[model samples]
Each structure stands twice: as structure tokens, then as C-alpha cells.
Target: MTLPPIRFTADEAWALAAALAAADACAPYAGAARTAYQKIAASMTGPVSVAARELAARIVALPSRTDAAVRAAVEEALTGNKALRLSSVDAEGRESDRVVEPAGLLTADGRWYLIAWCRTRRAGRGFRLDRITAAAPTGERAQPHDLAGLLLGSVAAGAARPVALAALAPPS
Candidate 1:
């Protein structure tokens, strides 16, 4: 079946607004977000649909949930369906490189994570933004991966909340 655009309830919309506000990583895209929101908002009057409201909030705070250039490159790769090379330091403080198919950016507890299909590891991985030292597009095409599925499987230690997971996902 074809996927329909996801909709948010009133509470979800409010949560998204709060999430966006706390998304300091995405602050650089404020102008773009406002422009996009304005364009979307222009179509409706007075009150908006829950989906539109949620979308406006998400758009305003989407992209660059970390270092602007690194996160921007990753987001560009995701939008273009291209592979990206990332240099990051793990918890061990050792640096490693990976070519990943970009999926989405997620923020939980004020920390940002880049969810992706890692060619180096041959699996899904979440790289913390602060640990990523460099990121650039590889020019190679990327295969599509289920963003939600990757997120579901990646969250561990029972630290992630369902509200965060739901608020961060892009429309299907």
C-alpha cells in the first residue's frame, strides 16, 4: 500500500513545537524553516490542520540538528539519495570513517544523533553529532532505508521516549 502523510494530534503538535524549540542544533535553519512554514501556512486560513501545524513546526526545526556543515551535508545526502562519508570519534576517543546512506536526524534529551545505514559496519548506526568531526557527500547513490525501523532498533537502554520518536520522524 502507498504510504500516506503522517498526521499529528493537538498534543503531538504542541510537543513538536516544544521539541523544535529545544532543538538548538537546528537553529541555523530558522530562516529556511520560517520560509517553508510561511509557504505552507499561506494555503490555509485561521486554524490549520493538525498535520499542517505539526509540519510547520517540524520544518522550522528540521535539518542541522548538530554541526551546521556536517548536519547539512548529511541532510543533503538524504534528500539527494546519496552516500556520505563521515569522520567521527567514538566514546573511546578514536576516530573512524564510514560511508553511510543518510536517513534522518533525531534529537532526544537535547542530544542529536544521525541515523544512517553504515556501509563500513554494514548495518544501521547512530552517530552522535558532537562526535562527528567531518561529513561530506560521496557522490555515490544511496539505497533507501526505513527511517522509523532504524530508529526503533537503534534506541537502547530504554532512554528514548515514544514522544521523541514520534515527534522526530519525517512524514511517511
Candidate 2:
């Protein structure tokens, strides 16, 4: 059976662009998403379309700064619901190895961060992509955790929340 065309807003498009751009496997999906964004923008009225087109262009043009191999491993951990072994350096330049349950990836300010429940600290942590020296799938299934809850309640110091697509809405 043929499916009806799906409708998505500019905000959703921007969110998807931000999420996909941080991944190593962004090439194929980015192209398709851009085409879809253009189509959606065409269907929108007035400034929304203009804003969407501009945002689409900017988001697509922004280069990913996350290390490819590390991004891949974290992505795998998330997709496979497996734990991730991470070797990362703290701000003070101390390196530590830890296992974490990959919850989500946040990209902001041209940087990527892996949000996870840390086994080392027994708490949630947002490991910056640049700080991660290595990432590998641990093959062990991750413990169940709610991402929204983790984001809201964690003691992740200086954890400025990731923006929602609705926050990117064009001025009213």
C-alpha cells in the first residue's frame, strides 16, 4: 500500500540536521534530508520557508568536529543498546578509561558530546567529543535508563540542555 506524504516542520528539519551532522554516517542521510527540507520549505508560507531554507543550508554546511572513529563507536553503542568503553581526558589533562551506557549525542557550538550513564562515576556524564581519545563497543547490553530523566536530573555540571527543534522556530 502506498503511504501518504509525511509532513514535518522547519524545527524538526533543523533538529534532524543537527543530530545527523554529528555522525560519521551523515553523508547519505544529509543529502536526502536536505532534499526533503527543500520540499517542505516549498510547501511552507512566507518567512518560514525562507528561514527553513537558510537553516537547512547552514546546518548542512556546518562541518562536524567529532572524531570519526569515536563517533562511530558511540553511535554503535546507542543503536545496539550496548555499553561503550571510553578513554577520555579530563580538562586538567588526566586520562581515564570508563564504561558508559550511551544515551544520546548532543551537538552544539560546532562540538559533539556523548551523554551517558557513567559506570566509573556511578552518575550521568556528558563527555565532550574532543576529550574522548577512544571509543569502543563493549558488547554488553546497557542498563535501562530514561534519557529525558537523565538529562533533567543529572548532576552534569554546566550541562546546558540541548535545544529542542521548537526552540528553533521562526519568529512569530
Candidate 3:
């Protein structure tokens, strides 16, 4: 389906650039969005007669996603229902069918992780969403534990930290 091009004001583009720098996976999308906005700023004819060269300068710089496959993959993963389950390949080359009560999604160190409650283990687990082979919700809801609170007051805190740090952060 063909969609109309997006339009953005100069101010909007500048604001978007600032926001994109702080964002993780969406940075590429932000760049594309900014480009559309810049085009609008140039052709805009009204009382505001801005310089053309300065228009580009106001744009927020972001990592470009030239690969169609990568862009599609990222779009598919992030758009639509954030609550939906996803299937992807994992690190060990094993298919992991997990019923996760997804709490939040995080991208750290260039990898996307789902912070969810794993039904099989009956615990809060961080799954590398990209590695998931397949994901489908069971229509069954599981109680999510406040892992942060539990770990803060338990021995698990020590274990979660590095060995060197764990020794210093032992359970009180």
C-alpha cells in the first residue's frame, strides 16, 4: 500500500532529533522522519523565510537503515500490538517456545531483550527477543513478580552481579 509522505515543521524536526538521540532502536526511523520534515521546511512558503542551508543543520543526525530487510524486520517487531508474542532464533540455535507475560522491552548493547515473566521457569527472565524462534501468547495470564524488589532483598542480588561486585554486594 502506498502512503502519503509525512510532513514536519522545522521546530518539530529539531525536537525529534533531540528525542531520537536518547532512543535506541527507533533512531533510524527518527532519521527518516526528520528527512521528510526537512523537505517540508524548505518548500514551506509563508512569513517564515528561513535559509535553505540552515534547514539541514537543524535536522537531527541518526543512523541510517539502508537495508530493506533490516528495516522491515525492525518495523514488524516494534509496530502493532506491543503485547503480542514473537518467535525468533536464540543464541544456542535452539527453538524456545515460551509463554511470556511481557512487561517491557529493552534494547541494550545492540540487542533487543524482552523483560517478561517466563511461565515455564515461573520467574522473571530476560529473553533476547531477536533470538526467539516463535512466540505466541497462551491466552493465559501469569502473575508478574516485582523482580527488582525480590532481588534487592535476596541472595539473588549477589548472584546477578559480577563475581567481583557480588562479593561486595552480598545480601544483608
Backbone collision count in every prediction?
0, 0, 10
Candidate 3: C-alpha lDDT? 0.48
TM-score of each: 0.60, 0.59, 0.43
Which sequence of candidate numbers ranks them by lDDT, best first? 2, 1, 3
On lDDT, the candidate that comes out on top is: 2
Model 3 per-residue lDDT tens digits across residues 1-172: 4446555565755454444444433333544655654555555554332433354456444443224343333344334323335454556676666555665444455544555665676666666644554554444444544545433443334334334345775483
Model 2 deviation from the true structure expressed as Cα RMSD, one decimal place: 6.8
Model 2 spans > 4 angstroms off: 1-63, 152-172
lDDT of 2 by residue, 1-172 (tens): 4346555576765665455544333221334454654555556665655665566566534454556687668767888899999999989999999999988766556556778899989887889887888999989999877555567755444454445554774542
| Model 1 misplacement above 4 A | 1-20, 26-31, 34-65, 156-172
Best by TM-score: 1
lDDT of each: 0.68, 0.69, 0.48
